[model samples]
Target chain A: MSAMSDDDRRAWAYLAAVAEPPCAPLIALAARYGAVETARMIKARKLPAGNAAVLTATQARCETDSASTDLETAHRRGARLVTPEDDEWPGWALLALDQASTSVRGGGPLALWVRGPANLGDASAVAVGLVGSRAATSYGTHVAGRLASGLADQGASVVSGGAYGIDGAAHRGALATGGRTMAVLACGIDRDYPSGHARLLEEIGDHGLVVSEYPPGTTAAKHRFLTRNRLVAALSAALVVVEAGRRSGAANTAAWARNLGRPLGAVPGPITSAMSVGCHQMIADGQAALVIDAPSVLALVEASGHDNFVRSPATPIDGLPPDQFEVIEALPAHGGLRVEEIAFSAGKPVAAVLTALAVLEVKGLVDGSSGVWRLAESW
Target chain B: MSAMSDDDRRAWAYLAAVAEPPCAPLIALAARYGAVETARMIKARKLPAGNAAVLTATQARCETDSASTDLETAHRRGARLVTPEDDEWPGWALLALDQASTSVRGGGPLALWVRGPANLGDASAVAVGLVGSRAATSYGTHVAGRLASGLADQGASVVSGGAYGIDGAAHRGALATGGRTMAVLACGIDRDYPSGHARLLEEIGDHGLVVSEYPPGTTAAKHRFLTRNRLVAALSAALVVVEAGRRSGAANTAAWARNLGRPLGAVPGPITSAMSVGCHQMIADGQAALVIDAPSVLALVEASGHDNFVRSPATPIDGLPPDQFEVIEALPAHGGLRVEEIAFSAGKPVAAVLTALAVLEVKGLVDGSSGVWRLAESW
Candidate 1:
């Protein structure tokens, strides 16, 4: 529907042949010498290094053989060559890519075939990747939905690898909240790898975008999922693992997230649930924060200066004076003590303690039961 | 059976009126004035200041009613005044008694009704008090029994209030293993408040010892349970909560132990069970160490110099060379990689890898499943 560039089309075509990751490596090499030049060098040198990339391009051509009628056809696909260093390329996502086994050489990102209006890796736009096991339990689905919807309600975009269970739940949560979410697939944009999530995948493309490192017509494999996780990790400042078993793929993603020093959040679950094991280990080892709610997750990320998200708990207490805390401090951990006892300890006059207690009661800072006082439910 | 003293008889008569804990304040006060003179000064003063020795004598008397006879009567009973400064007195126990209350005096124990061949408060002997829910599940009972037996096996004396559930389980564990134990009661030594366990209580008194702060004929009251917790906390260098629910009474004992600066151990359990909630909360807040086995509990106490108990691996590797470590390092978090891979990474030959794997596997450092390897346990 739009005018496309010839060089971009040629780059896209070249990417079609690459079947391997360190796709970044090939792309970087291509960027340095141009795809045609690099391809020529590879074949001439009979280098195994470029074999993966060349094979991928060849496969894409095979799958879309009749689709690209001629060389001119490549120029009309509306695609472009966006390398890791491109000004348009997200600097944030490099956090994910950086963790991968980069090309033994200096190359990274063969070439990224990102197609979306929203910058996939924009730091200003809050993006969080919600990931977990594909064989997720209902609890996992519930948590993923709740956390994603919460992030979206705060105007943050959600990202995930269009898979089953957690990934789908995250996308649906954002969509249901009337927010945008992107799906970074392991296969080509034109090919939904799972095939079962086709409808949801298409819906995401319609509302947000579906991105892939592979060019058009490429299929996905198990290895692709691991590679896919990196994109999910790199695209967001914080990666929250909603649910993951001990050996779940989500653990790998979490490992990558942690290695990048990114803020990681994991929800706590019953200790007996296998899905909760990885999260427990993560929280136990101090690799993740135990986030139980949306506000909490947002607060953790914002506190990290990860995405610059902000929260203003709109209420009288948000602007309350320090003196007001006297009421809360007086509340006992073992329910409540007598008013006189609280007043005596607070070092305030009986009338003053009563009046402040009343005011805090109205403001929800204190819950007065009979003559005793306890902390209000704002916590 | 032994000589009698008029002072011992009168001490017992006076003890008949006061309860265990208040006895601490009384004896501490009595000892302050030198003999009963100082104790009377403290008892007469009540809430006000008195001789410092009242602190010691009161705590000792509170520990156990003064045998209702003269010094000769106490001597006949094979018991004598064990003061705070007594060389046989446990220094670690004094640490707990010091914090009986906040804003109000809390820790002082008037006196202890102790009768044992071993100095009841000997610092050299390790004592761990195991307390938990009166209604323990099988899991709690199993863990308590194993932990108690393990401690007993290490020649550590077990101390408990001798209540039901965890306490009863611990005593049984020690008895089954033929190890020593002490029962500190809230009622008179001659009276068993829980009639259901009267015979068991008697057996313990005969086999080990039974102590109470109340004098002869004093009955156990609800308030006495709280006073009883202090004794449990004070007698041991560390207190381990085997099973505790939200707001469980065991938490109170743990809090007391903590306030005394004694190490606390809490066994982790399935979070879904209400019984494990308090323990989880304790471990979560760093108030207690997460102990799954006897070694962990012993490790913590020993580190604090309570007991020098350590458990070496069944098959010790001892100063292994690099070649052996190579196989150990290559295992998965919970599984083993192939010996070839391990050896390859270690820069050794396949034969060396197999030999190392076999040796380590037999020693429990590595486990060979299929052709892969993993650590025996996650610790």
Candidate 2:
């Protein structure tokens, strides 16, 4: 947990306090000369090769604010700074983000300020993000809550932003199910942005985790939500957009998920509802798979995983009706058999054979013709 | 208009009277020996090279009933025999079926017994089939009706069976809109099997067409409905399954549409609705596109047409907000520019530029980063 030296932790905290996450120049310089040296150089008014505007701004802010005081404030709130170098850092997701094309300057967070009992590494290993519109319909909320609960019950951590509608429902669903749920905030973990979900966020911090890139006391800005979306996408094995308007923060997270090659699943709502338009559009464009419920979501996760999951058809010969299976056996592969022939071969009445054949045809087990039937090619 | 001679027409009419539509043996024999010659052979109790069981049964029935009498009955019922040799055969669809592998012996109808003022060729040239479950929910019927109405309004003929639920709704919608609609019946066009839809079927004959493969007085058998689905799929430019239970007849039509390589679409409903499971499964299997409304359905039809239709993005330069368009124009192709740089180039306030960039990002026209933005690759 104390892999970072005292000076190194302070330097990382100082940069995090003054600068926004994914500061490209700071990240690059930190990679090259380490966070302690990068911090000193920025404070000394040194310039990078390109885009020093962000660095200059951070340095100006550093002149007025105390980085040590910011770190102490975060600690008082029971939050700990987790940099890439920290032993407790969820490196798998964040490290993968380094190779992704992100909306922010750095591919992902320079460091995560987290407060919770849940282990970042273990919880994140099987995370499924549940995000959607703040103005989600009751249908959307119900669907989100159920999916989140199912995902949590399946031992996958449910990650989401601490917004009002879908996000709040998802977190509450997980907690209600007695499962772990994490909230990734746009503002400081200590300051709940919606102002209404303070209790919910507090409970998340107590039972699961509340994570942020910004230090304590930082306010959530409009752009910060968009910037923080990449984190949500990056931290999960898969991202499920429960319901989103055509243009919403949820769409942005979807874009990030796609750009990162994460498996994207969208819960389909009624097409008549404007809330589900983005989802339908995504499915139409082949950007997301239509996921109706929790089982489908898990199926998508399994199929998209490195193992190459293949689903076995629900109907097998043993599962078919006895008469239908007998009829299927009576038919030929290359051509077909008349119902009378099938009846005689299966030792069934002609009318009974016809009925069985009809049911089998509907089940896609056989094809029926003019009093003739055959095994379907799919069989 | 009279391509078939009197003898040839009578022979084709005789075959349509006793044999089912898509009787493969009859189709093959007719193709080999012409309708008159095929009829003569059947009358002599002769057989084809393969699968003569259907033809033998039809010939045995023909021994007692006269072919001329059957034609007289159909003619009295206001139904004319339209064969492949005739000018009004509507052969484009059935000819395409000649290339398809179907469940019945023949790939498609050898002759269509049609009763209506509408010309089959002209009416069917731009047809769109809207079919679904007979036991549909109100939601399914509503969507089917609206989509059918929209399709008819766009100068495309709406096609469906004269059954209850979604099919009836589709036909009624087209007729209510004062647009062309044709019902492809599983039973004889003269005998509306549902009885409840008799008036609706009669009205369709008045305005559009009531078409069938069977001659007058044939009943709608369960297998006939399944066999009838291929006609619905083959005769349309595209087929949309509005709402279908997992094993409904609409799913069979969807399967036929896919097998025939026709563009297929399915309307998305509430996921909780069991009726939508078949439609959703089709979408998940990549057998159909998710179409929300009639416009989207038409859009798919256009996109899937022979011209290889490419959609023009909804938002062009003129369609975008001036500031957003300017910000997009200010972005670099190779890399990205900071918000300040974009603001300077676009001659707008930094805050205004940021706001515009956010909108543009949502529009998927531009990519915004940590204070930097660029044109999205998709744009």
Candidate 3:
């Protein structure tokens, strides 16, 4: 694994610049000299005479120092770095790079600082990303734990943010059940935030993996947390949100997963629960998939384990039942049909139509206004 | 409304088996010619060999009871014997009658006792049934309470078994919300069991209603409790079980509701919860409609309110996205395809395939298994 030619190292360093562009100037330097000679050209342009200001400014002070620090931390802990050119690189990460090329926010780290022997690049496997609100209900925690254990029981490794509530429960569930789990960190892997979970992290490191984009000594920052959400979404086969607030980090991860074409699954909660609103929204939207059990989740991963991502639905409707067809046909040409007219036209009594209409509303078929049912914009 | 003729009163009583059976039978001397003839020929049946077994039983029991007994208790409490001849009799109760006139295990009550002014005979009205486990989880209690309140908010009279757990929670929720609720007891209405709910029952009696089929002073028996499930199912437009065990009485009420052609609704809980297993099985078997919220329960009621129970799904499935049509058509029937395969089949790029699949899955046009995707069941 240690044997590598200069070309391989050079390609990794080049991809590092493209993959982890700190700013515009750094991107320009990488673009100019193809990484290896960029420092010289940048120095020649910005030297008191010939100093690579763009390349040296970032790599010299940040990349070099960070690498040394990371290496020192890595040496003390026997960890290593894996870049795009590494034999251990997964195609899924490369797919992320391609996606980042089209997006402004970008994909992930140029080099992942890893602390365990996880051949994520190995064919036919799944990484389960379980996330939820920090203030999850006990029910949510229980569901997360069950999903984690079930997925592990099926030989799938669990991946989650190491936060409390659903995240904590998921990791602990895997650990307690003697299963593999990975804790992807926004902060440096060594400096664990929410101090109480250090033991859990240590256990995960022992049997699973803990990898981060940031240098080992870097402190946890809120922005870093969100930025790392893409990695959590990208590295896994599917993202399962056990619980989420209306605007939660779990929801953010789900959105990214959807945008990245990764499968997204969410556990349903009580409709009245404010914490589950995000999940409801995701399921409502054409984004996340809905699963009630771990088998449903595993079924998804196993079916697409060999591929980068699974295909979408292949039908017209979730397959509308007969009554739904009637109500839909009863709607007016432009505006929604009055509930009265719909009932009459569908030949269903008024009460019967009303219930069908509500189901239609949730499914985003007919939008109701002033007691009339019209087709939804989404429909 | 009080313009009932003598014939009408007799007709009502005859339907409820209150005075006499509809069929003419050999009376002691004349024949048992239903309530009509009982009104005209009370003397036809001498004291012995009358078809009024229930009536004779009631009358003789009164003789054994002294002035200081339950009869006095009933009189003091102002409880009235609401024979089916009364204008306030609930027509919904007729649903409990054996279709073939078979000897019902629990036949029509000798007389229904009443203490409330709410008319069960109103055409534009409803009774909502809430039932579940005696040993329910907090989640169950919470859902039952909210569902009951929602029904009451929608102008329904809540009906439930006067049992512990979900039933009590529903009753309390309805009472706290200033809604009409009825506690149907297996024992005499005055008697309270599962003593912890005595205060709750008293409150229901004061604010809503407490009803019993048993004559006053009857103690509750285990068989009677099971026997009581029919009234809970028959008396309402729809029955919603908040949480039920595999063998809970709630399941009995649900089965009866289904068999009676009433819409049956069930609240879903965490799949891991044993309490929710009954609910899950019910939904899966199509025995009970899944109610996600108050609105869904209301929808079920509205759909089931009329004589014809099978209606369009309260929720309609939105059709598939336009762009996904080509993708859907191109999908092989074998199973879910990898993203690239679908994109190639549809003559689209990987990103387009991903986006379309997400939207399609949301529309329920597709179901993506682990890494495999396929047409949804509906499709």
| Model 2 chain B: ten consecutive residues of lowest lDDT | B306-315
Among these predictions, the greatest lDDT belongs to 2
Q: Looking at model 3, how many pairs of residues clash? A: 27
Worst 10-residue lDDT window, candidate 3 chain A: A42-51
Predicted model 1 interface RMSD: 4.6
lDDT of 3 by residue, A1-379 (tens): 3565655444443334322332333433343334445444433444222224344445444334234445667657756666544677664533543334346555445566667666645411467789999899988998899889988887777888888899889988887788778888877778775688888777777777777766667678777777778777777778899999888989778877776666888776675678777775675453556677778787656665434543344223323664675577567658767777676555466787899889988887778866767887774
Ranking by TM-score: 2, 3, 1
Q: What is the per-residue lDDT of model 1 for residues B1-379, given as tens digits with 9 covering 90 to 100?
A: 1243455334434543443355444443333233344434334544344434444444444444344443344455554544443455453454335434341336555555555455666522588888899898787888788888988888777788778888888878877787777777877665665787787676676566666655544578878877777677767767899889888879878977776666898876654467877876686566877665567677778866554121123124323544575456445566456665665444456787888878877777766666577777634
Ranking by lDDT: 2, 3, 1
Q: Provide the TM-score for each candidate, comma-separated.
A: 0.58, 0.77, 0.60
TM-score of 1: 0.58
Where model 2 places Cα greater than 4 Å from the true spot, the runs are A3-6, A46-57, A101-106, A306-379, B1-8, B46-57, B66-69, B101-106, B306-379
Estimate, for each residue in A123-186, the C-alpha lDDT of model 2 and write its tens digit.
8878888999999999988888998899889988899998999999999989889899989998
TM-score of 3: 0.60
DockQ: which candidate is best? 2
Over the full model, what C-alpha lDDT does candidate 3 score relative to the true structure? 0.65
